[model samples]
Target: MNRSQYLCLTALAAAIGFASAHAADTTVSADVTAKINTRTMQKTTQFDRFIITYRNGTTERSSATAATQNVTAAVSRAKLHASANATAGSALGVTWKRKLAIGSDLVRTSRKLDRNEALTLMQQIATDPAVAAVEPDVMLHAVKDYVAPASASPGGSAPNDTNFPLQWHMRPGNGTVEKVGRDTTSFANWGGSGASSAWPNYDGSGVTVAVIDTGVIIHGDLNEDYAGAGYDMINDSFVSGRAADGRSPGGWDLGDWTNTEPYITECLDGNASAGEASSWHGSHVFGNIAAVNNNGTGVDGIATHAKVIPIRALGHCGGYTSDIADSITWASGGHVDGIPDNPNPAQVISMSLGGDGTCLASDVSGTAIAGAMARGATVVVAAGNDSEDASSHTPASCPGVVAVASVGITGKRAFYSNYGSTVTVAAPGGGIYANDASSGTQVDAGFVWSTVSSSTTTPDQGTSVTGGMAGTSQATPHVSGIVALMIEAVNEAGHATLTPDQIRLALVNSARNFPNTPDHPIGAGIVDANAAISAAINYNSVAPSIALTSGVAAIASGKAGDAILYRIDVPTGATNLTLRTLGGTGDVSLFAKRGNPPSNDGGNADFKSVKPGNSESIVQTTVSPGSWYVLVVGVKDFANVQVLANYTAH
Candidate 1:
């Protein structure tokens, strides 16, 4: 068919399909094709216009207007290379779009173009004298999918919230069906990171985690945890506004619903399937990480005490990678041209969105991520849901990032989860595809439940809606929350904040072994919250040690109440086991115990040396073959506290 005929037919089909699906509140997928040439009617796909980065020191001011003028002039210069008949006004059909808010020099095109056209335009734009580099704007989507069950009901139970019980991913296994014919009983306690166990000690207070995804909604359940107005990076004038381009304050969900009558006509490349109901994705993600707890209303979040800095980068039909990259930089307190300096810099950045490409150091997202890491923010990303090797996805495949894969309540890799060497750990991402085949539709029992909203427009516009969502998108926040808990623990212990590498190591090293082997190998097993907190609190030095026959000795130093850990071996028939603390002006107490230390402080110690002053002594007459732990707690701040242990061999 001719190009005109093809466009007319595609629009007609899309309109009919959308009308039918709209009446039923259902979704339909359709194949769309566009004629690039007489021989090539390629699939109508999305590609960003040329994004050109100018060399540093070329522009005096990094404002949007300044960047726009510079790029416009460059485009004019590039037009000289166009066909001799090309007019200055319409050469290459390129128009100046807004300058990127995150990167000062980068500028985008005014309209989306086909991949080949965008590539050709980029090549022409690269010839400009001022252009340092140019690349196509790659599209990224929210790493979440909303499955509308045949008969769905909000499930979960908390004292105040009625939907806490449905959140099986947040608790130990509850005998739910996570996989076909498999009950999660074997992995009952393997879910979550034992976050509840660490609740009493650290609720993630005084920590900020930036949720970089679709904008968040203001749900009642998230009120206390909401930090403040976050920036919206969707620069489309139609979606946001002309004045809001580059960015505007307030991270609000503007309803991503598409495919309806009027909206279907605006579908990219005339594809109807690209439209979807508003996922409220950012709200769900943030809710999983920092929903208010003990409020007598909703499900508890893993890091209830932590606040979220919601930065909206994804919108209808997903978002552009350039916007997301900027959000990452700005959220981590990096400078972005148009936006004001961030008042609250996030210590952790949680990205539950990704695209289908390997991350390259030269790419915009990679550069932004590196900046965030340099600022000491721990980045957590979702492994794609394509069920392919995670190495094929960006951010997840990026170096120095904690790429989390999804696991069902059964402690196995979720059927839809991507896995491979790129995965850093696994968390419960919910899989309700098994067991009760009542109506043949997967039930809501196998999903992560979190805060949401009913409105398709305005922030916090509709009644609060909390329900279950399944994907690596849901699994990502669990790790982010656990990271918050780890940070809180480390901060409370008066230790230096952990670097991104250290935090990644602690989580991987402390993950619980999987109960059963998974179809794909995911990270170091599922994340263990209690264990992660323990690992963080005892990070670098201060770790439990083994005592030798000559009596392993070392000088422990820290602020007041700091605990130094040591262990001694007791051979079979061994008798004397002596532990002591000496040579310090500050009072230090010694406690001896066996096995792992208790989760709480109330647990009893086998031996205690509580002296009124600086020195402490302990001797155990009855010692047997096994490992024993000695805890040296500083009663007062001490620079050097000598810790010594002696155990007799059998």
Candidate 2:
């Protein structure tokens, strides 16, 4: 359809979405699709955008022309008509836009359709044996909790970024969210992502991070990489609210303010004044990842030495999953028809946008992530702001993505952050409330400081300042930048490039323990940038195991969820060699594998010792002589952990 309205997910309507943590993953099964349709349709009755996929090897998937023709025939069979038109042969005025990176088709219609009408139409389309899946291209917004910073804040201290003191979220904290009226220094180091500490040792040099959101506006503090692969992905003029009908070169933000004619009514609730300000969302997220340092302009980014590639995927009333998926593929050096290949392929893909929906591994966006991972790019996404379990959202729920949950300076879960087992880590997405009390008054100091333009509706790049915004949207880039640092650390150490799995494990093992345990599971813990860099360097090393000789020796001491990595070069023909965690005060598990390091996630472990306590050993399988990697993961708060490797050379 030509016109579309932005509809908040079932939870965002009331501001506090209490979706069940047990929501099942999205599937093409009739029952689940029906459930998803029913829930989605309740938000709006109008539509125009949709994403349809045909199974590979089908006639529809044969060529773009063939796919379009078959879909046209299917819609004609559905007898869909243009809005307010009674002609049956109108066939809903459907037009195929283009093919997405995951082989899905982006299609639009001539007019909006009500829920029942669209459902019936989709059912008819799905009846085609070639059709694999079809769903409304629901809007995905920036996942920030936007409560304006209370104007009563004082200024910052040294580091000369002008607003460094306001950036408490970047430094290490004393395990508390300092309330208002306290001296700035008293809470200057509140628990945060530890970017400041990490920067001293690792600067994310030679790494590139893709900010795949509202695109970017090169600001005073932000560097548009000399060879950046930034591009605008918004193909729908209606969605973009711009004059351009198709994609373009620069991924600059032409203002996504929803106050204009169509967006005022479509994205916002008709009230023009209720429309949101142009969030400069992508710029802020980018700044969080790689804004320049020592420039004395605005805020300091996490990875100061890293270059950024801005990939515009969301605009106006948010964007479609199909477009976002294509962005993931493109940013990671995967193929996307028509668009130029990325000159600076991202080492990490950071997305702070998501819509509420289950994303199965086989789904469009899920497969796109898999493709990016295969190309050695780590995907990091916001866990959403609905305060519900992150499992209910796309991208975040997708397998292998680093789903980040928001935690305020105190290191407690932000009231608006999505949590649960789906979260990969927690970071500084500013908290709006006093001490994170949802009902209490909001404070000014809680915002995660970053760079932004002065304009509320578009690009005013020259007039930039240290602006602040909150949400997992802001928290996401923290981890993305840290991943860049980790990658750089490995490179600096002259080791092989880290696989996505290795990077993930390094984050998990190096995460700082939550100061005060959260009410819900946020992640392994807040990411510790310094620790992550160290962990990554250690995990990638091929050096021999330092303490694991023929006899038992202390391996490492750590708390629950900590992973200490070690490597042993098994001489040729060594057999019956056993690696085990023999002595530890608390519970720890052993995971050993050949060549690759295994993580606690249990996906890459060739041999595992997963008994109740710390006395875990791999005795069942005879070891072959090769370079063996070993990891000791804390099952509980453990200390005095010791490792023993008993083997005989044949």
Candidate 3:
């Protein structure tokens, strides 16, 4: 059955009080409850898939065949119970699916069994002396709500990109007509502050951001910025409806739309109704982060010059957490069996996909994230769209990842966005229902526009299209793009590449304050693209040389037109303090300030030296008993200058 037919049935079911609200857990109907009570529910015994890790040196062999044989031997030794009449190979059927880089195996039984029966079988298998760890292959769905939208136009001020007008998240309200109802007062001049403003200075030229989702489709806007076709983790040939064996080389988006028949048979369990459309979710997310810039056709990406490393993990009906974990490890330059090393290791990994669960160290997804962070890849994830605390979700709840929440054009918490202390920041994810009373209908005015496809089929899909989509899925990429810009700025500044923690710090410190305080903290604030870039560019050590008594100190204000800040502690009863710019070829000015520098330099300065030439001085008979700041400005583009601070204290 098609999705439309399924939706009609679902609406009818809802009217009859049969279907409950959609959530993470499965909903059971009265009929199913009666069947279970009577022990009449069809009990089928199916082989359960398990991810098993063997003891050290037990499964890691020179060849793939050897490793498989060793794992099989270990399973055989466990002597799991099976039917007495079963054939040799079919009895206790243990088949190897794949080898993992972390010395584990994806194993499955050939027999079909019920859930309880399968659990019993797995428990017996786990007791094997050779088995180090084992877990059922749990499924994880894409964390986004995929709704096909009506037509819409791009809105922003970028001249070359025609779709810029639709990109409300990229620019401030510069009195442009396109930004009419977009919370101009609160979010005005806040858009693209750190990110878009830094474009001319640094466009993430040398950085690579990995989009780990349903894979990326190369559109006109994203073609030129492609780093390469990354690896595909969904090894199923039937999933993409293409006859390809094993996990293929290229990261391509095969449609993930579910038909009504399957939605009823599998998802709804012959009771529930409704199906979903193909999201082309990865493509939309990719466009937000690295779509080619100034391309006449579509919207401008935040990190226009950065190359995208497309890594396909989620596929039909979402994906298994095991596959998602493997993709994360592989994307961040970790080793994965059967695939070649990732040539373009990502500096920033964007995961707009997640599942409902707390992140634990024992879980594959959490372990993979830790590995990615250890390798210095900054991971940005969507704080789930459940509108509940994000701490209940995996990946977002995982420690060290930048969990992003959603806000609308009004600069308020998006009604659907998940909140909690776990969220690192919030970005424009669009809230269509803000103005409209209609709960679920599309509103063109309140959405994030990006690249998408109109086709719903596997082959001969629709041509390139752009429109609005809303979710934490949209917010995740905004932070990813900003991080790309930050990384670029840091690299250009001749500083060592920033670690994941440092990048998070820069983003948190540089975020803009929220217009209205949210009930729960979304993050430091909305991510300021311009401020984050500035933070990255201006990152310097806070340590200052201690001023000594009767000494000539030499220092160079690193760059022209830059301010060098210095601090000195004036102890009690200290006397005769003098600070001055002694010599330099170019004009240099000095100021003695008591507190933070004000908007203008006039009121805050206790003393200022604006001499006619390259020298200036400030002297005080009795020094104050507290900390004092010395500000040095390069008036005439001075590269190096000499300064002296002499004091006599008893």
Candidate 4:
């Protein structure tokens, strides 16, 4: 068909989309010899005019306006052309490009419509017999079109969801939202004295978590106890400093967003002014992630005590995969060859940016991400804002990372938040599309409120300070902070050297599941600092109940392994206990050494002395019966840092 005729036919098809539901099966077949290029059409529409907005501010777009055209005659010509093509048998098959909605008429008939009425309506529409079929309009989540909540003042009488800590909604609040502000947290009321609340000690004094995003703007909130800052990986510059090796800190009055890659032309027209505006996105994200929680001046962070490693990655249009890969490796303390070691090695890496889709085996980004996991760093990635299944996003979909989905204060899924089995947890990331302006009640599904850039303290750090912000980017820091808390709790309990897996499990098991969402929507529910700390603090030793006929606790070398064997049983579900191990500098090992034991201790001889080959029982392995207590003693190993000397008796 001619171009004009084809355009007219397509328009007609669209106009009849809904009306064709009850039409007769009048099929149209055509055969013609023309080379069709599907790929060209696909490419043209791939990223055609996508809609995006500034996450921090608002923008307006006018209603669409298109010039109207009349093509009634053109449609008739296209129909004639189709018939001619069919008769010629140029193409044999009937190609049904559009699947007409055909089930609505049947559904309406089954519902309440009288048979005669349904038939009458169908006949009227199908009289010409050109209509093939019709169906109901498919509905969607209404994400893009959904109106967003209005912004509210930070100080308000009503308990606003935004005012709550980042992951507070994931866990039921200790009380109501109104009471959180009144609590004496470092973030809420820094340095104020009161009885210890849930996370009484969060001053990340010794631990460091990495914030891998746009570089941070060194604001007062983060710099209060800021131990140290690192370099910008996006452009090899020291974080908060002008240049990578420049000794001086960044200059004052710098904005948050930096322009590492300058544009050739500010605007195509000469009248436009040149400036930097996009660099602050990273600074804003970091400010929320680790802006000293409860410093008594600015907003509260999930971990007020934790320190951060700012690994700058994003800049310009978006960060490159190579740069991001390098940042991830460096932050995790992995070697990048001759480069200087990361001054602040993070135990966890928080990445708030992500691209769409699942990772292919050949995906370079996915492979590099795995490198970070191998280095013992816990990675947290954001499920994108597309609201589609996360199976289609990279980095987030990459295995060995925790995928975070957004939730609002009301505990509902944010309309735009993506979800899937890959999601390990959910947090409050505010949605901007829907809301009540007067009430400042935005959809609370995924709103995570935290600090953002207010002004730039360093000329080189870019000129941004602290301010209010929200996003999964904002919510993720909450999880990172909880990880920091878990580390702190474990360290305080004396297990300062915990494996990544142990830390991950403790955090996951202790999360608070939301009442409204019971499944994959919120991975294991929201993060709970109090529950996690409680579990870590009360860890205990257990004795296995498995029966053994006989076993010997052996010890080799001069290390403290050849000492104790005391058989003690523990009750089920019990979590606290005290046990004795061989003391003093002498090499001695304490083992509950599993196996059947002699009916009785060899009286005083077994208790005080050791036979050449007989198992020695020196230490008292004490605990309630039924729990398993095995060998635990400090032994010197030639190769390993610590080794199992031999299972001895206690």
Highest lDDT model number: 2
Output the lDDT of residue 617, model 2: 86
Mark the regions of model 4 whose C-alpha exceeds 4 Å error after superposition. Answer: 1-197, 224-228, 236-276, 360-363, 431-447, 454-466, 518-520, 535-650
* Per-prediction tally of clashes: 12, 8, 18, 89
Sort the candidates on lDDT, descending order: 2, 1, 3, 4
What is the TM-score of candidate 1? 0.69
lDDT of 1 by residue, 150-173 (tens): 235353334675566566677644
List candidate 3 stretches off by more than 4 Å: 1-47, 57-92, 111-114, 146-148, 151-160, 173-194, 224-228, 260-273, 435-442, 540-650
Candidate number with the higher TM-score (3 or 4): 3
* Deviation (Å) of 462 in candidate 3: 0.8
Flag clash pairs in model 2.
1-48, 1-109, 80-92, 173-189, 173-190, 173-191, 176-410, 177-410
Candidate 3 matches the true fold with a TM-score of: 0.69
lDDT (tens digit, per residue) of candidate 4 on 1-650: 00000000001122132234224323322111001001111101111111111111211111111000001121232221223224342211111111101101111111222222222222332332222222111100001112112233243211223343433333443333322322232121111111124445654557778776655555655543432455555432332234452222211212333233233131111222332333344544555455554445544555566667666555433444445556677777766533576766777788877654344222334445566666767777776666666655556666556677765554445555677655666665544323202133333322333444433333343322323334455556666766677677667768645555445445544555564543235455555667666645554311112222223222223333322223443332233333332322333333332111111121112123232322324433442223122333334321121212222323
Candidate 4 or 2, higher lDDT? 2
| Model 2's TM-score against the true structure | 0.78
The best candidate by TM-score is 2
lDDT of each: 0.65, 0.72, 0.64, 0.40
